[model samples]
Target: MLHMTCKGKIHRARVTEANLDYVGSISIDEQLMEAASIRPFEMVQINGLRSAQTWQTYTIPAPYGSGEICVNGPPAHLFRVGDLVIILSVGFFTESDLERFQHRTVLVDEQNHLVDVKTYTRQSAHHIRGGEGK
Candidate 1:
């Protein structure tokens, strides 16, 4: 059996633009995508920190080092420039894969520059559960 699991995440990324005139999808810096192993056009889940809104969208590659994080199409109305958001992508994994699976979580500065990249593995999962007193 395959389980859907988080593949990568971009945390606290600032929105650089919101284009109501554009079609759809979130445009992210290609460098950031590469660092997180996120593919272009991959489905993503976005959580707006300030607006408290959560939505699903796909990703598009912007220029490397562009620091772009834009909300396009109708969803543009749901976000504002400078809004901090969390972007995530998920994929299916088998039981064996889960044992060694690693997910990347990227932290970015206000300008959307990469600050840190954290890898979560099965060991990290244990630590998380332990922290929760589970």
Candidate 2:
């Protein structure tokens, strides 16, 4: 049983069966609709994953086929294609609480997957030790 608190109420959810091959989700209450801003039994895609904080993304069925939407409260900077991001909770945010990212870029593909643009580099200890010895 997973509980998602949103709109000052608690929502109960169930994940009956889940494996690397497939995932199943069900909700017995109406909170799922309010939380995700989508109707019941709708085909939604995971737009982005939430970190250990408040952030999530989901692509809903819009008149234009599909539209990816982002909901952020806490900030995290890691994403890739075909990753299943869980939606922890949802809330309303004021305009002042929103701000742009400093050094990151995110783009969504036609398939509603989020693509992160950043380079990651790893330096060995030998490289740092050589500079320190000099």
Candidate 3:
């Protein structure tokens, strides 16, 4: 998992789901897309592609139930419906939610694109609270 140091107090957060995002108007690899069509977990990556960016979707491995973030890869069925993730917001709570989110997960039937983030939640907090930046 990619690690970023933040200034705010660090609390043990659990991972819920990993969502994939691509740059520009590019779409997931045709083969990977087909795989996801059958099995969401069956995905592949085409590095150096014109219409894609590196992303990794991460999820808690259980036990503590930590947060999950999807980065540097494609979307897959490894995730289920109704999962939680982290939303790194600007302030404690504001109108601009940005890309940072908590308790967000991919929808069951909406994994075709795998980048739709509208289905995510702010963990158990209902909304994103501000944490001091590092």
Candidate 4:
């Protein structure tokens, strides 16, 4: 059997724009996406911390170092510029994979630039390795 598990997260990312004109999906800075191991066009769940709103959309890469986190289409109304959000991506894993799996967590500054990156495993839930510059 396969289980759906969080593989990566971009925590406390600030929305830089809300483009209602765009078709759909959230656009993240390519640097931020890479830090979280999020792939282009990968489905991601976004949670707005200020409004408690949730949106599921695919990711699109923004210009590198642009600090962009744009919410597109209908969800644009739900996440306005400057709103803090958490972006999550999940992966399918076998039961055995859980034992060796590591999920990545990326922390960003107000500008949406990655400030920290950590890799954590079930064996070391409290302590994570790897930091800034990841």
Query: What digit string (tens of lDDT, one per residue) describes model 4 on residues 10-77?
Result: 98899999999999999999999999889999999999999999999999999998999999999998
Per-residue lDDT tens digits of candidate 3, residues 16-124?
2434443212122232222222123322221212223332322222122122223322432333223222222112334334335333322212232233222223343
> What is the TM-score of each predicted model, taking all chains together?
0.92, 0.22, 0.17, 0.91
Which regions of candidate 2 deviate over 4 angstroms? 1-4, 7-35, 38-64, 67-77, 91-134
Which candidate has the top score in lDDT?
A: 4
The parts of candidate 3 lying over 4 Å away from their true place are 1-3, 7-73, 87-134
| Residue-wise C-alpha lDDT for candidate 2, range 1-134, written one tens digit per residue | 22222212111122211233222322212323343344444433222322222223332222321222222122223332233334333334443332221111222333433332221112232343333201
TM-score of 4: 0.91
lDDT of 3 at 1: 33
Worst 10 residues of 1 by lDDT: 125-134
lDDT of 4: 0.91
Query: What is the C-alpha local distance difference test score of each model?
Result: 0.87, 0.28, 0.27, 0.91
**1 or 3, greater by lDDT:** 1
Error of 3 at 88 (Å): 5.4
Better of 1 and 4 by lDDT: 4
Clashes of each: 0, 0, 38, 0
Q: Which has the higher TM-score value, candidate number 1 or candidate number 2?
A: 1
Model 1 residue 118 CA deviation (Å) reads: 0.6
